[model samples]
Target chain A: MAQGMEIRNLSAWYGSQQVLKEINLPVSPNQVTAIIGPSGCGKSTFVRTLNRLHEIIPGARVSGQVFLGEVDLYAPGVDPVSIRRRIGMVFQKPNPFPTMSIFENAAAGLRLNGVDKRRLAEQVEKSLKLAALWDEVSNRLGQSGAALSGGQQQRLCLARALAVSPEILLMDEPASALDPAATLKIEDLIRELKKEYTIIVVTHNMQQAARVADQTAFFLNGELVEYGPSSEIFTRPKDRRTEDYITGRFG
Target chain B: MLHSYPFRKLLNRAVTVLMLLAVVLALIPLFSILWHTFERGWPAISPTFFTHLPKPVGETGGGIANALAGTGLLILLASSIGVPFGLLVGIYLAEFNPGGLGTVVRFLNDVLTGIPSIVTGMFVYSLLVLTMGGFSALAGGVALGLIMIPTVTRSTEEMLKMVPTSLREASLALGATKTQTILRVVLPAAIPGILTGIMLAVARVAGETAPLLFTAFGNRFWSLRLDQPIAALPLQIFTYAISPYRDWQTQAWGAALVLVTLVLVLNIVARLVFHRDGR
Candidate 1:
């Protein structure tokens, strides 16, 4: 599992409006990297570009090199669907397939690939356990996933992504819609998930980034201001802008 | 009896009376039709009217069995074929295209919907009726189905459009393929709305008489074949109305009453479906 990613001079535009501009970063494998910036700073757009999902928007385009290992994801011959399969993502809010059963929710990816029943059952069980949701939901796998609580829905979404066995997980504020307890559980799950998968998280919560991320990247106006060990970035950032962000002076 | 300030109070009373009089004016036509139809129609409605075939122009005490069965079968055929195709086009316009193509398709559907029913019947008559060498139930069903398409398409699109963007974004974000997201997430949430659309389309097509007149020309016999002229309630009523026999005219009014009842029932069902979903 090659988990680290190298992005070079990435820029994104929505129609005539440019959101992300000239971003460069290298993320380490089996580590938690957090991108923290103010609202409308293009943090979400930057994260979505990693999984090639940003292009789903109309009149939206990305330019520059995004390399997942030696493969340039944006290369002319590269397939966006395959890239997405390998680099799975979760959104800020939980959105389970409302019509599907809880069991089916965790098995969507395998089913999409036309996997047989025996393998699908194995993947669903493994993914659910991996997300630490097996015990709470073991009895009612036949129930509609829309019936689950907000926190459980987020976990279900995580299990769904994990079922595909993706190498990299890009979450755009995964726990922002969750309550404090649910947020803590999700943050803890992220820490646990990073043991095997490369995790990239974008959040506005400075404290959250400090607590869970192994590395922190502070961005301003779509530019990377500073990237370093979490302790160093939060305690002693090299750039004055980074210091100002961590110290709550200004975004 | 008239005194000071009588002008102001009299004016207010006059407005109240005028409003009530307007309501009564509206009801008079409706009530008159209802009473007149029932008064003349009941004597024609008997077990024989449902079981036995209609008698000759001057005779009485027969049935409209063929017309009832024909109407039912034609509606079934038209709605079954038209509803599914309309739903697919609607989903495409809402989820898949959502661009210039979708816009053009929707505009065309709306334009087709606004076309008069008789024109649709006439067109189908000229095309299928002329080609097939005569009027047939198949021709009528084709025309009715054409009329149904626009209504189903418009309503289904409106319902599917009501689904929130966040729901779609969330599904896509989870690495779901576009097919999986639409089938599993979007369509299920929009099912009730789609059903209501189907009901509305059904009602619109069921009450259509002008289209069937040219396509399914009145047949006295209960014709089972789609390739031949067939019996329908509206066509039978037309046949009965022109006859010099008072009995035939009364039977026509009876068939008309039955047709109105079916449309009213369908409208109620459609409203109920919409109400359940809206709540």
Candidate 2:
């Protein structure tokens, strides 16, 4: 339950071109933190840096300190796969594995870590319920994940991320692709998820951040322009740029 | 103005006729050659021609049975040897080979694919025949497999590479090892394309006479041992086409017809696989 991520002087690069500048921020555990910024502001980059998602991109790299609770994620001898297991992600688009059934999709991460069948099955069930997808899909565990509707696919992705019982869950614009009703459902799911896993979401929708987030960080040009309680950040930001971004003046 | 419109319509008709004539020019010769080949080879196809051996000049008739069986076995052998390597090397190039090594390998594979089939035959002949001291079925198969590898490799790699990168990333992101990802996700997804490549390569190597001429050396009698001399369809055709025997020449046409049929079947199969899996 000691669940806050501390990021100190984080910088990242794609090939040789630096995409994220040095930054400092903290995400409190078991709480929802939203990162809001304009396009190419490194909002996504900052989230990916937490679990070293950028490592998978060839020629892309990070130079930073990311600590979840007591452990420094970027420390030598820390396996990326392990870090990711503890800090899961749901991408912007819902990408349930095309070949996997709903049950298999949720069980994938556990199987990767060599979990046994019974435990994996239980975990998949638990995570799907937690993601609010279990009731709808409980009877159809054998259905292909790709056969789900878009909102359902997003929830399946959430269920997949949750299956490993990760301490942190990173969602990149999880609801942006959803319709209004589905988006509200996701927002509600985020509220419910905050009771368990520490959540960090990046969204272009300021209203989404206002609805689900406890803390909000405004990023601009790879820099953290402001980080404060959502109420203050929305009502009385310290910086003109944060104000501009929040007001939808310009990215 | 209305009368001038008649001249415009005439120009359109003339252009349409010219285009139609051009299409006819392109298609006529292709069909004509096919027709002639069928005409010449059909005469060689009778029950006795299929069952018996090729006869001497001015004699009754015989079959290309030994050659047909030999060709089948040799190709089967070659495919057994080459297909797995093609699949593995292709997976390496598409899924794992990284840095400058992948580029280097891709370039080399392209070069190998471009090399003439006759040269591949000669190369294999030197390595398997002269060095080993005999022309055997095994030698023929290895030579054919070698010829097959690059063609199979390039096509297989291209087919696997065509699978969406997202599919690969999705597997990797699931924490699956590279090998696991390839085995369970990537390869299965590209199965049909890989099969098409294999079929095409098999068909291409089926009628190759140059390699077997040196490697198998064209046995007249049916032989089963890989180390012994072997007969093949292409070699029988090559031998009969050049021989003075009128009987051999006709049997050569018969062998050519069989070879064409085998190639055609392989091609049709490949086409069918592509059609079924294209979506």
Candidate 3:
């Protein structure tokens, strides 16, 4: 039942330093859209502004019109909390709630939304299964989240996001810190999740974008240079910048 | 390089020897105090030292049991008041960045930590003892609680600041409100450090004789009433140590041993708890 997202004429800044300048894009529902760029390219900031999280910093600001289906996310009286509930996020580093057990970390979002206590066990199990982490973690549900390996912790974070049943999932380089094996696992999980959720991933790995994304958008210096079907974007880019970055000439 | 190498090695050895000497010098007073307390206070220890009330001044065989009970009450009261207040101020400083107000509060807390214990006692005396028309356990606890606030606040702030920002972001990204993120993630992660602070504050105030000198004023009889004046270990030790009676001076040594042991045990327990939590 989730709808596509449409971002129009969006710009963002941290104090006087503009990070994202006049961006427009459309993300289809129930598909993976990968945003690729070098470091400091505003890829993370753009996604953060999508969920109104960029404003949390001391002097960060945004002027944007983001529509999730028919509702303008930045329109008057729109509560950022409510907007975020419908769009969950995962960060570059794996951060499972340090004090919570594996089971509790999965159930945190549900608990916050006042989900029934009796049903939490079932929900947590379902989320872990969806994240492909159940088999590894199910036996030791009471152990602290910190006890997990780096890769397992990232999957646990995925399970936590999925538990909330958000319409959209934003992953900011979810597998960047992981090993190749773990990275493949997350990529496979993303492929599976695209069936039920609209997903946007920000990554520095071109191969990862080629592997996981239905659509690919190339960014450089806070500007979106090209966005198209993954096949076209990789094989035949319209812009020189996109072509140059993709071809390993320069970043 | 060849010419300097031999001289550098000799210098390093000399420095190591000097550091070892410094360490031994620092440890001398610590070991000496422990030895003296154990030697002088050993005979005075008995079952009644912990279980019975203090005897009349000239009588030779009583204990500081009333003072022990009063100390327990005072610590409980002070901690109850100090912990929550300190934790909230620390949260404000760490989380809210309350601008100029936060700077003012931090400066004041540092100043409070520097103030003499007797001065804190006098302030409490003027504020509570004079206003309430008597020295009571409540006034003594208030003075100790005031002393506790600065240490607790500073430690809590430091602990909270140490919590990684990623955890807060993770919580917020999951649609948790700011308050929920802080309560569910930040505070829980910082618990070990905050608890260490609280334990240290409690230990710091436990041996304070000057603060209780004019506030609790000292009582001979067993009194549990918070409003009434109460006896405490430090007050009992100080009173007896200054008395002409040799038996009372002996009792003071016993009380000092008990007090030091209690504080040492508490610190050990706190360290154990924090270590376990950290893992």
Candidate 4:
């Protein structure tokens, strides 16, 4: 089952240069939440903080309370490795492991966890189907993941992320590197995935937020300006900054 | 003052021809060495030359079978010691620590690579030969292994660094520990480059004569024991080439040819094996 998340007074910094301010947001379960903003607005950093991926960078720090379904992710006993396993991430670029085959890429997470052969095969097939790439690549599972086209590679990455069966998926500009058709396909996959996962996607494309997200939050200079239902945020933004951003007045 | 399109094109062609000529000039010495070796060495390369040990001075029919076996054994012993030690140090520098101690280790490694091989031989001579009370193949292997360490470590570190940070991040994102990510993803991806480095180190140490002079001490007959002085191709070649006997001089050329061919074959085999597995 999908799990919701609550962020209370979350702030992040890279060597004392604060990139995310005191941001409090509630992410609903089994729904897509889109974090939209201009460049360098801390949208990417915000999602990375949820999965504890932000702290991996040298000198990067986070002072925040992120509750993943009642457990404080930042609590002393909670391990970041376990938190990451429950919250899968997809990056901006399509980074399929070049040394790995298509099937191996999808099964990487499970294999690392020491899953056996028979169950690993079943989970790989299921994940590939979930990512909507099984029909195109089912025959050539032994081929290198890098041999696929840009769109296919992105889908393969998605399959890799989904194979772990995480409750929440964090996508940082997942479709930005893809073409129009590939972007649309990813949008469709996101909408489909919202039924089983709590997805928080950070995107610069506002139209994508409107299409795939159930709720949208607008960020500006590390601050959350406004947030509401996608229709309300896009058409009737409550804050002046949010209105200007969606109306094409300023990014 | 700018030239017209046709004039610039002509200048480009002139520069291309100059580069081609330079390449041919660079290749001349290499081709000349191969031709010279074949010319002087071919007639001496009989079946018995490989199967029989060196005959007494002035004798005509003999082979460098002992030297060939000794060189093989020394390389095997050196690699067994060097490759694993170098690989671990390389992994530490590349993955675990890139600052502090890693910086110091990297600098020392570069300096070690530049140090004279004879100095390495002398150091091993004092440390192993003087302690063991005599020259031995074990001492020679230690000297060669010391020479190989820096080469293998530097190459392995460079190859590991070439693996993109994105791949490491990908593996980590899947909840794999740092050890798992390196062993499974980073190391496997860098295998071809690391193998090339190993082959280069092996080729370099195979032809070394200066280090073995004090360590192995050049045995005249077949000796398989590690504690005994061993015969090697370079040592035999050096001894035979300077002798007054005309027949031994011819055998020296044959031994040189064999040594060169072994290094060449090692490089080719490594390339073929890794090239297939890398993809």
Candidate 5:
């Protein structure tokens, strides 16, 4: 069974400047939770903090309790590497290792985790199929990952992350760079992935959030404006800022 | 159609003529050197030129086989000593700490590169040659190695910097350690450029005679030991060119041609290697 994420009083800073203020949210298991906001609203920072990726940047710091199932990820002496292994992330832009072939790109994380070498090919194929890219890339697995088109590259990145079988997947504006057709395909893939892994997506497209998310959280100026069911938040938002944002009013 | 202004057209034609003239003037020395070397040295070319030892001072049927072997050995020694040291320092500057320490080291490297080759020769002559009590191939290799360090270091740093930061993030996000990410991802991406840099550095050092004049001291006999004096191609060419004998001067032209060809071949091979799979 997949596990839920519980974040409490999470705040992040880059040197002296705080980016994400005290934020609290409950992300349920096997569901997609979309965080939507305008530009510079700390949506990206919030997603990065989930798996402790933000702390790697020079001068960046975080203070919070992020619970995965019953385990505190930020507990004393807890390794960020282990936490990241359980929570995989796909960035906003497609970043496949240019030196590696498509199959190698997908197997990178699995190899890092010391997965059985004999099972690597099978695992890579399974992850690519789950990402909806197996048919497109099956014949050209030997080609470099950078040779693929933009949409295909993004899907390959998703496959690379999923090959490790993480319990949760965090996507940061995964489809913002894609065309309309590709965006639709990615939205469909996200829908399918939510059935197995807890998914959190940060997006700028309000229609996309409404269409794919079960729960949505609106953020503004580093603060959590509102969080609730997708239908209630979009159609009957309690906060004026959330309504204005969803209604195309000064987002 | 828009009418062409007569003065503007004349100005454009004049500028074109001037640029063409400048290019031809710049090419004059290159063509002359090639023509001179081929004309004067072609007679010296034979199978024995690559196989036989140099004839005595009064004779004219000798070859520079010992110089060729010595040059190869010298370049090998220089590469072994310099490439690894330069690459490691460059990696540290590019990846580990790019603060005050990196800046100071980079500044020092630049100063080293700017120093005249003869000055470096003098420094090596005073340090290793004087200390070792005599000129040896080891001293020449040390001098060339010193000259190679800055070139390789700068090129390595530049190549490593060209790798995008997103690649690093991608590896780190996959739960890899920093060392793994650098060794597996960053280094592979930078390899082609680093190879090109090393080849260019080798070419620059291969034709250098000033450094070897005081270090190798020009041996006439076939010597393979690194501790003994060795005769290199550039040193042979220099000694022959200075002699009053017409035969010796002709051999200098032949050796010069060989040196230029070696450098040209290295440059072409480096480009081909980079283009083959670096894309």
Candidate 6:
């Protein structure tokens, strides 16, 4: 069973510029939660803080606690590396390591963690299959990851993250750079993955949220305006700002 | 303002011709040097030119065998010291530095690169020769290695900087430590560029005669010991080129040709090896 995540008074800042306000939310286990907001509304920052990736940026600081099950990720003496290992993230852009072949890219997390070579082949195949990339790239594992199409490379990155078997997967606009067909494929993958891993997806496309998320959160101007079931949030948002934004009145 | 079609055509043709002339002018010196070296150095090249040590001033028919071997040894020693040190400093500047120490090191490296080769030789002479009591291959290699450091570091920094931050983030996101991220992803991505930098540094140092003048101090016989005075191709060429002996001068030209060929071969070999590995 996948572990659930809880965010408590989570605020993030890029130097003095606060990107995410004191936002508290609950992410259920084995379900997809989508965060939708306009550009610069802190949707990305919110998800980044969930996995402690936001602090990787210089001068980017996060305040408040993120609990993965019973453990607070921000607690003193907690290793961020271990936190990251248990919680995986995929970026908006498809950034498969260009120097590595498809096989190596898929196996990166496992290989870097010093997993034994004996089980590497099986794990790589399993991860690729989970990401739905095995059928397309199974024969050309030796080819450079960059040689794959944009959607395929993104999936390869997904496989890389999945190979580590993180309990939670955080994706920040994973399909924004992809075409419609590719976006559909990624949406399908996200839906499939939520069965095994807790997922937090930040997307600009509200329809994508409606299609993939079981629960939806609306953020605006660094504040959470609404949080509820995707059906309720999309069709009958309680907050005026959420309704205005979802009705395409403004970003 | 739009120009007339014919006038634009004429101007384009005139500019094209001028650019072509400039390109030819640029090629002239390069081709001329190769042509002259080939013409003058070809006759001196023989079986004995490679296998035999230099003959005495009044003698004829000897090779720069010792100098060739000495140059090889010096480069080997130099690369062993310079490449790793430079690579580490480069990695420090590119990946770990938060600003204070990195800025100072970068400035010092820039200053080091600008120092004249003779000055570098003098520095090494004072530091190594004066302390050790004599010029030695060790001192010479140290001099060349110092010269190589700045070039290698700058190139390495530049190459590593070109690796996208996204790649680093991706690796880190996968739970790889900073060191693991660098070794497994960042360094590999930047390797081709770094190799080019290393080759350029090696080529630049290979032709250095000033640094070896007081360090290697030119021997006529083979000496492989690091602590002993040694011969190098550039030092031998300088010694022979200024001498009154016609045979020795011919040998210097031959050595020059050989040195150029060696650097060229090194570059080509590096390219082939890196090309095979990089993709």
* Alpha-carbon lDDT, every model: 0.86, 0.85, 0.93, 0.92, 0.91, 0.92
Q: Give the distance in Å from residue A225's predicted Cα in candidate 6 to where it truly belongs.
A: 1.9
Write candidate 3's Cα lDDT for B1-279 as tens digits.
355988989999999999999999999998898889888898899998888888887777888889999999999989988898999999999998787999999999999999999999999999999999999999999999999999999999999999998898888888889899889999999999899989989999999999999999889999989889999999999999999999988889999999998898889987886888775
Ranking by TM-score: 3, 6, 4, 5, 2, 1
- Per-candidate TM vs. native? 0.88, 0.89, 0.97, 0.95, 0.94, 0.96
After superposing candidate 2, which stretches have Cα over 4 Å from the reference? A135-143, B1-26, B46-61, B244-247, B275-277
Across A1-251, the per-residue lDDT of candidate 5 in tens digits comes to 68999999999999999988999999999999999999989999999999888988878999989999999988999998888888888889999999999999999999897889789999999999999999999999999999998899999999999999999999999999899998999999999999899999999999999999999999998899999999999999999999998888887
Tell me how far the alpha carbon of residue A247 in candidate 2 is from the true structure, in angstroms, after superposition.
0.9
TM-score (chain B only), all candidates = 0.85, 0.88, 0.97, 0.95, 0.94, 0.95
- For model 3 the TM-score comes to 0.97
Tens-place lDDT per residue, model 2, A1-251, is: 73889999889999888888898998888889999999999999888888787777788888879998889989999887667768778888888876679998898788888898888889999999998999999999999888899999999999988888888889999988889998998999999989888999999999999999999999999899999999999999999999988888996
Candidate 3's clash total is 0
Residues A1-251, candidate 4: write the lDDT tens digits: 68999999999999989999999999999999999999999999999899888888878999979999989999888988888888888989999988899999999999988899999999999999999999999999999998999999989998999999998999999999999999999999999999999999989999899999999999999999888899999988889899899989987
Range of the 10 consecutive residues with the lowest summed lDDT in candidate 4 chain B:
B270-279
In CAPRI terms, model 2 is classed as: acceptable
lDDT of 5 by residue, B13-115 (tens): 9999999999999999999988888898888788888777888889878898999999998999889877998899889988886788899999999999999
What digit string (tens of lDDT, one per residue) describes model 1 on residues B1-279? 766697879999999999999999999998888788778777777777787777766554788899988888788778877898898898899888678888788789989989999999999999999998999989988888889988888888888888887777766765567887788778888888788788777777876789998998868987868898888888888888887878888889888887777777877887787676453
Kindly list the per-residue Cα lDDT of model 3 for residues A111-206, writing each as its tens digit. 999999888999999999999999998899999999999999999999999998899999999999999999999999999999999999999999
* Candidate 4 chain A least-lDDT 10 residues: A50-59
Q: Ten residues in a row with the worst lDDT in model 2 chain A?
A: A79-88
Docking class of 6: high
Model 4, B1-279: lDDT tens per residue?
A: 999999999999999999999999999999999888878888789999998999997667999999999999999888988899899999999898567888899999999999999999999999999999999999999999999999999989999998988888778888888888998899989999899889989999999999999999889899978999999999999999999888998999999899989988988977886677666
**RMSD for each model, in Å, please?**
5.1, 3.7, 1.4, 1.9, 2.5, 1.7
